[model samples]
Target: MWKALRITTLLFVLLGVALSAWRNERNATDWIGPLVVAVYPINADGSELAERYLQALAVERFEPVSAFIAAQGMRWQLPRTVPVDFRLAPRVNALPPPLPRDGNVLSVINWSLRLRWWAWRHDTYAGHWKQVRLFLLYHDPARSPQLAHSTGLQKGLLGVVNLFASPDMNAQNNVVLAHELLHTVGATDKYDPSSGQPLHPDGYAEPAREPRYPQRYAEIMAGRVPVGPDEAEQAASLQQTVIGAKTAREIGWLR
Candidate 1:
């Protein structure tokens, strides 16, 4: 009887420790910042196109990315309460405010790129997520002047994408968006560049070469822009890596 009682006491103590640890972890994550997304105005035709793109993204499978994060045991959430807001142009500068000190702003379309430059010129951008993140959605790659060259602020090393580009173009855009987002957080591209870059570091490829880079095609940072079932696992892995890095940097995890 005494032996059984002692074993029960030990089990209870272990359970208590586990519960306490879990609570502490929960509290820690709760302290991380929120993600704020902003949209820039598109022309009537573009606006309609952008809306459809957003809807496509929302309805697309996110399982690959979500599962990847789950496997790594990380926590993340997209803003469910608000559909991202689009700001009308003209009066204000295309600038985003200072980093929330705890949060980040994700600008969609040209607005995002514009904001990134503002932050970069001012040296306000620490890096995406840590400083700010920009996500742009457009229909054409070769003809779009909106994607204009990047100033020193953004590396343009990686490109984040949207859904409106041509069927083939959209595929690359999806990969680009995910790849660029990861760059802000610290994931290097695994593809090669023509200039002897073994890996493109940014992970972009010509529309014709999409099939060759399996990692990008199968992974969230590359082909999973809309987040499909096959890519769900990759997305989760990406989330875990990016989220973990962001969280750590914010809380001095690196330090």
Candidate 2:
């Protein structure tokens, strides 16, 4: 009976979150003030480098996210700044299990349950249940050379950013972080999942620009600079990226 009740409660919570996310997506012009996002660090590899990287992290490192949103909001003539206040929270010892690559519904639900269990065990949502939360799993390149893929869920106010623990990777890390941040706020990925390339027009920053072979900046959702018809490169930094019209619309920065 207890197990059944727990499953029922989880389903209710998921339903509520799904409804909330749907409403938030449709109400594009509603600005409910600055959204607070808490970022929790996790030493995925249990390496000294990962520990040191976590120790050195500061809220200032994510300030660019706020700046980027403010800039885009200004362009859309938003009533006020769509500010995102980022807070660096305490670290978690264990990482959540990997998400299913197949992305089936049952697999996604199981993944969410496992992730929720980990978050509850670590008190990740204890004080900030109302605010958005992000779990950043940092992997030390020296220990694990393979890059860790990231994920974010719109229904839950949570995300997992898998990144390397290095100062040189900070810029790129922010780009990935920002992209996942938008994902939590109902922004969909604009890139081609198969090729990992930005789709034409919607993913292109300057879609209307003449001679569009070479793009000066990347669409934040796309996360790549299109150099040609069949080739592209990752934006070195967030400075070279912009929230495009479609993305701005999706995220409620534009009407």
Please name the candidate that would achieve the greatest TM-score relative to the true structure: 2
lDDT (tens digit, per residue) of candidate 1 on 140-246: 43345244322112233222333344444443343344444444443444422233222222322222354444333233333232222222223322432333333
Q: Give Cα-based local distance difference scores for all models.
A: 0.35, 0.81
Q: Which stretches of candidate 2 lie over 4 Å from their true place?
A: 1-29, 125-130
Indicate which candidate wins on lDDT.
2
Candidate 2 backbone overlaps, count? 0
Query: Per-residue error at 244 for model 2, in Å?
Result: 1.0
- For model 2 the local lDDT of residue 218 reads 94
Please give the clash total of every predicted structure, in order: 17, 0
Give the alpha carbon lDDT tens digit for every residue of 5-78 in model 2. 99999999999977876664444235566777888888888889988988998889888878887787787776
In candidate 1, which residue ranges exceed 4 Å CA deviation? 1-131, 140-174, 195-255
Error of 1 at 165 (Å): 4.8
Residue 229, candidate 2: Cα error in Å is: 0.6
